[model samples]
Target: MTTTAVEHGPTMNTTATAVPRSSVGLVPATATLARQKISAAIRSGDVIFAVFGPVVFFLCFYTPLHRQFELGGGDYAQFLTPIILLQAGLFTAITATETAGQDARAGVHERMMSLPIPRVAPFLGRMAWVVVRMVLTLGGGLAIGCALGFRFQGTIVETFSFVLLVVVFGSALSMVTDAIGTVARNSVSIASVLMIPQLILVMESTGLVAAQAFPDWVQPFVRNQPMSVYADTLRALASGSAVEPLAVLLWSVALLAIGVTAIVVAGRAQVKR
Candidate 1:
């Protein structure tokens, strides 16, 4: 009997060793969380807003200003499309704050913490939704712009850069807002506060009207502000012209750095709580 037990032990050990241990991965975990976010956003109608927000914003600006801008020289549709895309990205970021806030209020983060996934999965999951919204906004904006006379005048590379820049800009902002939402209780108030600055930046920007159109006192600010710089870079890329893109690139980098740092801190805080 002892001899038979010993022999069986070796077989059992071998069988146990042959059975693999299942491991979770970041990609699959993030994907699952992302799908959760997408479904929630759909139920909340945030997904619908993603496609229509830019459409409404684009038409709002294009309808009244097109004739005047066109009369100034170039087609207004081509000139105005860049800012619309940028605004779409901003809108995506704004929506992220509210969603993140909702999750925080509902103890979603705490629930997720109990899982064996990476701590950064929640942020990445929300960002995946942000990208989806940005893509939807881009399609909607471009479609409306094309119908209104906008066209891609640049080479494939420049056009691609134009799209890439918008994504980077939006993603950076979304990260920052996500971090803000994770820690803050009043996310809706934060979102409302964000809009004031957003409106100021777009209205005072060279986006809708040339810098010269602004009062002389504000022209310098308008020309050199971050929004104007981004609009300029977007316009250059869209028109296949050469201009200094370094400023906007620098802005993007700075925002990304801030976002990364903020998000890391926010995640660490969550772990502690």
Candidate 2:
């Protein structure tokens, strides 16, 4: 019997070593609570800012531009609709990262960390919330675009193309903004940091002056920036013109990659207390 037990022990040890351990991650209940809370908060504010803001901004442009530009078959408001949607989207893209910073400041993140939830919960949960807000915000903008006389130029195929472009690029911007928020020491810092991109990089330059009015370098960059491309695509869709679908797709993928890379780098820099 002793000899038999010794022979079996080697086999038992081999089997034990071969069976893999379960990868540690967020417990079901904790993950559920985190997702629910984040989703609810984003949905509320996201609708208000992304949808309502664009609606109001479009109304202001309708009357004045109606008399000015002879936009072929469409009015100035129609031309401006997609641009306004892009603008509204920018406002809500950073919602998640901003909320995460708030959580960190409030000790919520630390409290969650103390529980059995996976270390990635805080990061992934916030990103999920960002995506939710993006949908709400961008959906609202699309509704506003329809109200402002924007319509799909072609079949259902083209409509999907426009939405795909918007979502991808919007998500990229949101991710980049989230990374910035992660690195920001406090809420004030995050707000202050976004001012440059909000005021300068993203603010409307379309239809204001001739593209030639700017320096050669500035002209091309301004025209091809993410917001600019989205606006251009929106206008094309609304006017029943051929849109640059490939350019938008390329830009969207590139932006998402860049934003994700930045977030990972910033996350690694974070020191656990």
Candidate 3:
């Protein structure tokens, strides 16, 4: 063929090359990714960080700190035992934000967007890790609590239900953090934004200090905050008393709603970028 003809033929062949078929967004075989993520979380100190607060809570009660107050039942360890679980939920959510930010910065999130895996898969995968991490931490907390003479006052089923409540809520909280991370652009912002409110409202004792003694102005809002509900539920669990089913349901739904809204907003921002 002449030079012009040769060039034209190759151009035609280039256009004729088929685009590879994309994978259907069917559920991915995510077992391997799940394992890898879980291993990484453990190796990266995520789980260890989750463990620290619980251990510290245990020790605080096991020491002179318990003498400062009645500690309800005079067994500060038991009182703090269930609270360790609340702390676990709080810690995982806070940590997930920074981790998610790192993943985004590393281009993992951007890369995933190019794939055919369902958009929800990444969130679900992270959520699965949240559960695994929370459960492992909860188990550790419980073990330490038991070792320190904190016994579950409820039936096995009741105890499991309480744990389930904590895990479900914790996962929802983690999703919120993930969405926040998507928009944070860096780790420091993530920490500053997510950690502060959590510490002040949840971990700190503005309302928890004196549930019945808060200032009238703060009482209304503090009573409705998730941490307050968490503390109450924990007290119930520790004492083997009935937990408020409605409170748990309401708080869980509220958190899930916030997370869902955040995810949708973050997804839009990500796509725009």
Top model number, TM-score: 1
On lDDT, the candidate that comes out on top is: 1
Give the alpha carbon lDDT tens digit for every residue of 38-97 in model 3.
888878877776766677766754576556545444655566666677777877888788
The TM-score ranking, best first, is 1, 3, 2
lDDT tens readout by residue for model 1, 1-273: 455543344433445446654646889988998999889888989888888888899899988988887776889988888888888887788888888998999999998777778777788989988888888888998889889888878899999998888888899989999999888889999988888888888899999989888899989999988788888998898888996877998998998999999899988888788
- Return the TM-score for each candidate structure: 0.90, 0.75, 0.82
Evaluated against the true structure, the overall lDDT of model 3 is 0.73
Tens-place lDDT per residue, model 2, 1-273, is 455544444443445456554544665644676577566674666546655666676666656665556544546656666666665556656554576567666776567656666766766666666556666666766676676666666767676766666666666777777777766678656766665676565554553222564687788877877666767776676666877777767877788899889778766755445
- Model 1 misses residue 58 by how many Å? 1.1
The superposed Cα distance between candidate 1 and the true structure at residue 152, in angstroms, equals 0.9
| Residue 126 in candidate 1, Cα distance off native in Å | 0.6
What TM-score does model 2 achieve against the real structure?
0.75
